[model samples]
Target: MPDWLSLYYEQPIELTHGEGRHVWDAEGNRYLDFFGGILTTMTAHALPEVTKAIGEQAGRILHTSTLYLSRPMVELAERIAGLSGIPDARVFFTTSGTEANDTALLLATQYRRSNQVLAMRNSYHGRSFSSVGITGNSAWSPTSLSPVQTLYVHGGVRGRGPYAHLGDAEYIAACVADLEDMLGQTAGGVAALIAEPVQGVGGFTMPPDGLYAAFREVLDRHGILWISDEVQTGWGRTGEHFWGWQAHAGNGPPDLLTFAKGIGNGMSVGGVVARAEVMNCLTAHSVSTFGGSPVTMTAALANLTHLLEHDLQGNARRVGGLLAERLRAVTAGLGLVREVRGRGLMIGVELVRPGTDEPSPEAAGLVLEAARERGLLIGRGGTGGVALRIAPPLSLTVAEAEEGAELLGQALHAAQDHMTGRRS
Candidate 1:
């Protein structure tokens, strides 16, 4: 593993197995999993539906590539197309979100005949070379070399930018103005503007509801495709909508969208959906070997079936609402907690220097370690790792939600006391 690869705690605990919302470590200690392996375990850990599908499919056949017809792949694609609102949408499977975004970038650039792209400030698309070029967060983007020239636009985050202090109406107006000005400065046409409806890796922060709808107008005028990176926000994780893009529904659907990380329930599965015209823009032949494997497709089909049949979206709304409220109430009086933000099952708690807006990355690290000690596992992210990311399995029960919140409260108090004593 790379030295830069992060472990959850100071003493990393290896997980042995999990069921529902709980997992056991190698030491036989159990934990209430709150991050769901960075939101990859969408439905639950070791869900029988998904395990059965994989078992049944493996018993039949395994390594047939895209050269042959695949019923599971075709069926999964059909269901995804219906869910994706792109007009005459075409689905192309990939193995990860990085590949999905890479494909989306390819489609947009070829369709528009331009390599220049617009991306939101503080947004994270993926880790691949092509995807990293458009990433707005300098922390996550490791290199300056790129295949495309990217213009970072405003509105992914509205809490600490040039337009942070403005009211909602004013913030929207300012971001839209910034977009217009940025477009005017471009010497050539842009291929597309890719954005995450809710900025996921950037502390799970969200812009005003209509920010993207407003940006969509400008992109349309310039013939720039709109690509929504729904890797972290899709599959009804946001609770209020099926897809994150629906939050900006006033602009209708995006021209292209990419998804991954959750649909296969720990199995690697990802793909891109685009309008038929854009998707078919590739004149050259292309194929992904492990992308639409029968095993993965079967798992995805079963997982999607489980999600819809149980209406986990509704569960996310009800349980996530309770969790968020409980979190806010527990941390309200703590000066170290800056804010509790995000929607539904996906949430971020930002930490700061007590009484100031300055980020406290150290405080976040302490809290993360403290949470692990309490047998609670969460995630840390943001430009400086100053936010605690909370995204548990959608199948989390009401009791589990309350228990996790209580554990988190204890963790926060412990973090606060430690930080204070160290300062003194």
Candidate 2:
């Protein structure tokens, strides 16, 4: 592994296997998995339907390129097109979210004939060259050299920003005005605005409801395309809405939407859904050799079917709501907890120094270590790496939610005690 490849915990354990919301390490210690492999295991681990589909397809065939007409690929594309609200929608599958965002950028820049783009502050799109160009989080973005001249806009993070003190309506207006100012300063026409509905790597932070809707009005005026990067927030993870952009559904859907991470249930499935005109704008020959392989498509189709048939979206709404409430109650009196924010199952507990607003990555690290010692697996992320990110499978039960919350509470208290020099 590269030196930059970061691993969790002071002592990381290798996971051997997982069933539903629980995974066992090589040493045979079972843990309640709260992070869900960075929210990739959407429905559950080792879901029978998805496993069976993968096996059935693999037995038949696996590596038929896009040059061939694969039934599974076409079928999955049809399903996604219908799910995507863009008029005359088209779907193009990639192997990961990075490629999906790259394709979206390709389409947007090609259609608009401009390389200048707009992204949100404290946002994380992906690791690819093009995707990194639009990332606002400095930690993830390794270099300043970028193919696109990305001008970052604001309103992605609600509680921390220049307009954080403003009321909800005022905050929206200020962000919109800032966007207008950015547009005015642009030398030429900008290609698009790419943003995450809820920033995943940026500590799962999000704007108030309808913030994107307000920004959409501004983008529309300048004929700028809107790309909703739903890599983390897609497929009912947010609970309240199937797509995170629906929270800002003042206008219709975005011109393009990129998705990955959960749709394949850890099986490398990603794609971009766009209006026909935008998707068809590419005149040059292009194809993803392993993008929509029959095996992966079959897995995605089965996983998506299970998600819809079981009403996992509704489950996320109900169970995630309960989990969030439990977390808030547990962390209410903790001075190290800066804020507990997020929607549905994608929740973040940002840690700060005791009795101060300063972010405390050390406190977050302690909490993660404590949670692991107690046989609970969560995640940590933020601009300063000071937030605990909790997102279990959509099929997480109420009992599991209660158990995870209790474990997390104990972990929080332990970290607090350690930080205050009262280790026990």
Candidate 3:
């Protein structure tokens, strides 16, 4: 209706620009951007160092195909690998998170030579070929869920899940058992177990304790590839760690790690870090033209440097801790909220589902609309669309965080009052 582009949402606003944690409309009205471009721009809009890197790179060579090596690309790749801690890991950059995940999945397939993929019901890795097959977001996968799609999408390996949430230990255990059974049935044909270290779009939450370890144990025994989608949770957003997998590293490292979002400080840069074996499999597996461009690599390098210099990881931990606590208290005693989940800057408010664990999509929508109306920009993600995502820039101030939570609390209150009207 707004005529910017053909889109799916009911109402769309014309946002002009964003800085730090806020954006403005064409009318010059400012609004807080808590959504952070769906969690990709967590470093905030037009970050100085990142912008400088891009501008400087633009003056030089923009890109070169994967056939030739570039210094910045090599340097950034090494940095990514070092932070990743995946032995002898290598990087292959992409322009977006979807492409990164897609490529990672491709590498897994080649390495294991198997077709089966195990994913959570609410997981969202990407939308690219085969990746969509692995993505559990209903919106992106409903039509692709046919029996035929299931086979190819399942990649000739035994397919399973949209498993139970991370809140249930029994369900978590069962998911591991289920994978074991599927692997057993297929005679070890299961190629990979792909998951978000902290499910971002599935609602920013980590699985119960022993969850990752449980899966790791099984996958280890079965020699299954483990892929961690850190698209939305990486770059120190989760506070306790710079990477999501660290939240459960007691289990072991992932075979492959995919990162996007804040890696290049809102610039279009993404990459996958893989162990030596997995890296070898990919180099021998296939190739891409724009995988690693000089321009993007320079920006990524600058971004990483800024993150370290500013101790952004530490900031995220401090501010995010405050944000999470205020969030829990803001929604306290509110019947419309069921829970608040996630770590660091990645937070999710679970709307009341009444008698079930399933969130109330209607309430969530109302909160998004209300937040936007109240000079705050928030968004929803999750199978039920009942999770209000609050992933702001790591540079956000404590004041901004408090203001955001307070506004969201007001909006949630309004949401509860207008729920019936919205439904009608």
TM agreement with the true structure for every prediction? 0.99, 0.99, 0.89
Tell me the number of clashing residue pairs for each predicted model: 0, 0, 5
Q: Which should have the higher lDDT, number 2 or number 3?
A: 2
Please rank every candidate by lDDT, starting with the best: 2, 1, 3
Summarize candidate 2's per-residue lDDT along 1-424 as a digit string, tens digits: 8999999987779999999999999999999999989889999999999999999999999898899999999999999989878889999999999999999999999999999999999999899999998999998999999999999888989988799999999999999999999999989999999999999999999998999999989889899999999999999999999999999989999999999999999899999999999999989998889999999999999999999999999999999999999999999899899899998899999999887999999999999999999999999889889989999999999999999999999999999888888532
lDDT of 2: 0.94
- Candidate 2's C-alpha runs over 4 A off are 422-424
Taken over the whole model, the C-alpha lDDT of each candidate is 0.92, 0.94, 0.76
Instruction: Give residue 292's lDDT in candidate 1 (0 to 100).
Output: 97
- The candidate with the higher TM-score, 2 or 3, is 2
TM-score of 1: 0.99
RMSD of 2: 1.2
Which residue pairs in candidate 3 have backbone atoms (N, alpha carbon, C) closer than 3 angstroms, thus clashing?
115-155, 115-157, 116-157, 121-162, 121-163
- How much lDDT does candidate 3 score? 0.76
- Residue 166 in model 3: shift from native, Å? 11
Error of 3 at 111 (Å): 1.2
Q: Highest lDDT: which candidate?
A: 2
Residue 29, model 1: lDDT of: 94
